[model samples]
Target: MSSLRAYRQIVRRPSRKIYVGPVAVGGDAPISVQTMTNTLTTDVDGTLDQIRRSAAAGADIVRVSCPDEDSTKALKDIVAGSPVPIVADIHFHYRRAIEAAEAGAACLRINPGNIGSEDRVREVIKAAKDYGCSMRIGVNAGSLERDLLEQYGEPCPDAMVESARRHMRILEDNDFTNFKISVKASDVFLAVAAYQALADACDYPLHLGITEAGGLRGGTVKSSVGLGMLLWSGIGDTIRVSLSADPVEEVRVGYEILKSLDLRHRGVRVVSCPSCARQGFDVVKTVATLEERLAHIEEPISLSVIGCIVNGPGEARETDVGLTGGGGGSHMVYLAGNQDHKIGTEAMVDHLVALVEKKAAVLAAERAAARAAADEPK
Candidate 1:
């Protein structure tokens, strides 16, 4: 079945794999979802609180900015408490990169070309090697190298790719291969073009994002359209959906993008139809309520909530649990694509929540049993 599923898959581009702590990126690994913390890094407790929330929301990696010595000083505690690996965002400061690596950061976000002299870059590489930390060469259009800006005359895709290559060359010169690269721009076209060019130019893992992509609504749409193109083409190894909203929302949106592509799965995915006048029950409110209630489920399962029987039965046949609204204030409930029972409007949301929770427990137990049997002696 898995092979049959792969037969219809989008063939991903081949790229070298690198590890950020225990999490792997590229080389056929599941595409990772990441989000940056907005809390001041020096506030260890506050930062850890946000990291915990993002991790709970399915962030594979969490980045915390290290703009000063104080932030680096607090990194040790944050790293110790964080459930997921931490990436220290360091720019223009070679010393902070070294400090962050020593403080147990899994990766350092830096551009070797912008962090002072060649000697400084080499020192940072040495620190990364010594402390078993990876690096991310982040090139942004808003902060292109002066020479590149002058040469290209603007923040174009060519300029962004050149900037990435320049930083990449510095890492290559130092023999540092444990790194990934991202070329981002606020403009969707520029960012997409830069990533496409970079993916063609190198075998290194490409991190995808459209930086500073507005607030919640705008950012989600922009990121979906841009990153969706890259992902469908098998370009991104990891992704960050940048937004001005809560960092957890970024994680959620990132997973949603991946889920839409069937690339990665976590939690309960609700397939709901836009409510219409043909509905039998309040489909909109039911979906909204069910989404919140099912957020705690980590197992990958599908639930379809349809307004009426027009497409409900077909969709229900493909999901683990489903609800299709019916006339006279009653609805149908499906278990494993088979009609198991009928539920009333008054008990709809609560009943679905109970059914899903029960289903999740069964799936989790089966997974655990399989793992246990696999570990038993032959």
Candidate 2:
């Protein structure tokens, strides 16, 4: 049997906190969720639209690529319109990095090794300081520096860490200290191992990711496994779940990973069973529909929709609201664990949605009152 002790706790690693705009990362800050906009940076409206959607999905920070002069020029408008802090992604072009900072980017994503001469790096660092922007030293297994690749014969954990240190040294040598690092790879083992090694080797905030994982389903699973290992061991500070689908999906997946580990909670977490022959209703369809309907509820709550009485009541006992199917056309409803009432199959979806919305409103008001009370000059 799995150890019960594993469920009780996770002591996060201690690292210096840094601000990516107003959002705090590392130290005691809540682990933040991030996603990158795939829309062309020069298409300011399109990029801002995507950023808004990602933010609505609970993204704390968003990254936009600035590959040329036009993209950097557009950064001014995108940053101005974005609801969350924007990180300008620049590769091999120090001019774009400098321009992005002056354009009001909260952070700059650049691999120092790829940005050319030391003088250029110092200039970029100077720009970051002038604009009060933090930086992300992103080192990927697929894009390790040429010298490090030749040194290790391939992209391995050691090589990725070496690449990260090289970049860190560049910033430190230039007296730049406000930065986080990510050593990412699509290979789960490589990414996990590299992150673990990187976490141990530095006190700087670590940005966790499994780069270029895949599409929605495949990428979610791969990132969960890789990020799960690191998070369970108390390693990650901020996270981005790399997916090829909509940028919103990346933010959703990142929150789900954090939710599963009890590190953070944002929206409704549904605990439903995989329908079996003994199921009382269409378990799979019900869950799919409920997730879509409940997406608008931002407050964290748990709801279990079990098919039959086998494990239904037991699972429901642990959730805020629950439903367990019965032999008749109706099913039992659970509120705060105990059986509250029953409802026919036809009314199940609508009834559950109403109950969840009501519960969310009550919780939100309670939180507001608590905040108000705490603010009293006591």
C-alpha lDDT score of every prediction, in listed order: 0.94, 0.94
Q: Per-residue lDDT for 375 in model 1? A: 100
Residue by residue across 239-281, what tens digits does model 1's lDDT show? 9999999999999999999998899988898999998998999
Leading candidate by lDDT: 2
Instruction: Give lDDT: candidate 2, residue 186.
Output: 98
- Per-residue CA lDDT of model 2 for 1-378, tens digit only, reads 358766648999999999999999999999999999998899999999999999999999999999999999999999999999999999998999999999999999999988889999999999999999999999999988788889999999999998899899999988898999999999999999999999889999999999999999999999999999999999989999999999999998998899999999888999999999889999999999999999988999999999999999999999999999998778999999999999999999999999999999999999999999999998
Model 1, position 201: C-alpha lDDT score = 93
Instruction: Tell me the alpha-carbon RMSD of every candidate.
Output: 1.7, 1.8
Q: Where is model 1 more than 4 Å wrong at Cα?
A: 1-8
Per-residue lDDT value at 325 in model 2: 93
